[model samples]
Target: MKAYLILEDGSMYEGKSVGADKNVVSEIVFNTSMTGYLEVLTDPSYAGQAVVMTYPLIGNYGVCYDDKESNRPWVDAFIVRELSEFASNFRNEDSVQNLLKSNNIPCISGIDTRDLTKRLREYGTMNGMIVCESSFDMAQITQRINEYRVKGVVKKTSTEKIYTLPGNKKRVVLMDFGAKKSIAKELQKRGCEVIVVPYDTCAADIINLRPDGIMLSNGPGDPKENTAIIKEIKKLYDTDIPIFAICLGHQLMALATGADTYKLKYGHRGGNHPVKDLETGRTYISSQNHGYAVDESTLDKNVCVPAFINVNDSTNEGLRYINKNIFTVQYHPEASPGPGDSSYLFDKFMKMMED
Candidate 1:
């Protein structure tokens, strides 16, 4: 069936429909990863947005259960240049088309992804709608696109109830702000008893749990908008518990400590980003998926120090608190569907807990 991706600016691209027959309106962004489309689709961080794949071809290896970052796909829509014709992987259980269709996600193919990505890079991400019908009213569509906004996405994606995964080592209270499953798995692999909690859980309740360490998981939406979460984080900080955070959690941590954050031009959304460690003077290839970054200029150097920076853009990637057992990184160290170069950070968190 014929489909159209209409942006709020009135720009339209025609394509062929490949997933479920549904219309979707949401914030549209792009990813530059050459592989791991499955992981990208299921990542909760993409909760309120449609993703444009900058890579020419997607789903060449097909889909498998073990590759999922979350239980289900969270992307509102998927846009790609071309969908692979054949599923050839030995571990393949389903095709990407079937996976999205089963999840009732709208997908479009045969569009110029390069041009789309370039536009987003130049003009920044915008609200968009995916129409799968034969014909539609352009005026109404543009109005809907312009009026739409992504809000409360973190609460929608976060876990509804607290759950525990038992282990024999140190106890960790993982506050899940729409966390990827791999974050808890990484902690469990190291023998940490993981207690996953919702995004709005209070700091006093967390303290009552008597955790050896605290983990702030990645999530969706603008960091500055989550004012309540930031306040709770400040209360958590007063406890002096060893804390480790990733992606959105890192931004919230900075906000809790009185630092400010700003939205990026197009934001980092690929697996091959390079981040340099300022402390050790080493560079590591990292996996990242975020739209906002901590503003280094707004940081209080007396309380926190920059730890890692992006090699491509020199943006802040990691930070360490002076005289405190707290640190956070702007990239994914678990690497569920990307490189494992920075996985040692998990061990670093464990060492902090040990001390």
Candidate 2:
């Protein structure tokens, strides 16, 4: 069936429907990763966005149940240049198209993804609609696109109740703002008892648990919009407990510390971004997926210092709080579907708790 990806700016790309035949309206963004399409699809951070895979060919390796970052795909829609006809991986359990269909997510294939990416790069990400109907009114579609906004995505994706994972070592309370499964997996692997809580959990309740440390998790949406959560995080910061955060959590931590954040032009959503450690002068390839970054100029120099920066864009990647056992990073250290170079940050957090 014929499908069309219509941008809010009136730009359209015609293609063939490869997944469910339903229509979808959401913010459209692009990912530069060549592999791990399944991981990207299931990542809760992409909750309100329709993802466009920049790497021409997708699903060549097929889907595996074990590779999922979440229980189900959260992306509103998927776009690809070409959908592979064959699933050839030894660990393959189901085809990509079948996965999307089962999740009721719509997808479009055989489109000029390169040109689409170029337009997004020049014009920035925009609200878009994926129309799979036989016939549709363009006027109505454009109206919906202009009125659409991605809000409350964190609450929609976060766990509603607190859950515990028993372990014999340190006790850590993980504030789950639509966290990836690997974040808890990494803590469990370190022998820590992980207690995953909802995003809106109060600091007093977390302190009552008497955890050895706290972990602020990654999630979706603009950081500045989470004003209530930021206030709660500031209360958490008042205590001396060690804290480690990633992605959205990083931005929130900065905001809690009197810093500000700004949206990037196109945002970084690739697995091969290079970040440099300011303290050691070492550079490492990191996996990133955020649209907003902490503004270094707005940070309080007396309270925190920039720890790491993106080499390509000179954006803040990591920060260290002075005289406090708190630190955060804007990239994924768990590396569920990317390189493991930054995985050592997890160990550093463990050491901080030990001290």
Candidate 3:
């Protein structure tokens, strides 16, 4: 079936449909990763958005359930230049097209993805919809795009109840604001008893858990919209136990400490982002997927300082708190689909708990 990706700017690109025959609108962003399409599909951070794979060919390796970052896929739509219909990997289970159809995720293939990515980069990310219907009014589609907003995504993606991943060394309370499974896996690998909690879990309950450290997890959507969560994070800030945050967690903590976040022109979403550690003055390739970044000027100098920065645009990538064991990074250290260069940060967190 024929499908069209219609942008809010009235641009239309036609492609062959490769997913469920449904119309869906989303914030259209592009990722530059060469592989790991399976992880990108299941990542909760892509919630409320459509992902355009910049890589020309996708799904050659096939889908491995174990490589999924979340239990299910979160992307509203998937756009790519070419779609590999066959699976080739030894660990392959199902083909990508089948996965999309089963999950009701709309996908378009054989489109000029390079042109689409350039448009997103030139005009920033825009609202777009995939329409497989033979006939539809462009006026209504554009209207819907203008009215679309990514709201309440964190609640939708977060865990419904508390759970524990057993480990022997340190008791770490992981507040899941749409956290990836790899985050808990990383903590478990370090011999830490990981307690995963809901998005609305209060600081007092977490304190009652008698945790040696607190983990604020990565999530989706505008960070400022989470006023209540930010207040709870403020309370967590006062505690003596170590705290580590990633992506949205990093933004929320910065907001709790009087810093602000603004959306990037075209958010970083890929496996090969380079970040430089401020203290060490060394750069490392890091995987990242977020639209909002902490405003460095709004950061309270005495409360926290930048620990790392993006090499591409000099955006704040990490923070270190003054007189505290707390540290936060805007990029993923868990790196389920990216580089493991920054995985050592988790070890540092374990060391903080040990101290």
Best by TM-score: 3
Identify the runs in model 3 with alpha carbons over 4 angstroms from their true place.
Answer: none
Off by over 4 Å in 1: none
Which is superior by lDDT, 1 or 2? 2
- The worst-scoring run of ten residues by lDDT in candidate 2 lies at 335-344
Residues forming the 10-long window of minimal summed lDDT in candidate 1: 142-151
Q: Candidate 3's residue-wise lDDT over 5-98, tens digit each?
A: 9999999999999999999999999999998999999999999999999999999989989999999999999999999988799999999999
TM-scores, all models, native as reference: 0.98, 0.99, 0.99
Predicted candidate 2 versus true structure: per-residue lDDT over 6-61, tens digit per residue: 99899999999999999999999999998889999999999999999999999999
The better-scoring model by TM-score among 1 and 2 is 2
> What ranking emerges by TM-score with the best candidate at the front?
3, 2, 1
Tens digit of lDDT per residue, candidate 1, span 1-355? 9899988878889999999989999999999888999999999999999999999999889999898988999999999999997888899999999999999999999999999999998999999999999878988988889988778989988999999999999999999998999999999999999999999999999999999999999999998889999999999887779999999999999999999999898899988999999988999999999999999999999889999999999999999999899999999999866799999999999999999
| Pairs of residues at least 3 apart in sequence or in different chains that clash in candidate 3 | none
Q: Is candidate 1 or candidate 3 better by TM-score?
A: 3
Error of 1 at 291 (Å): 0.3
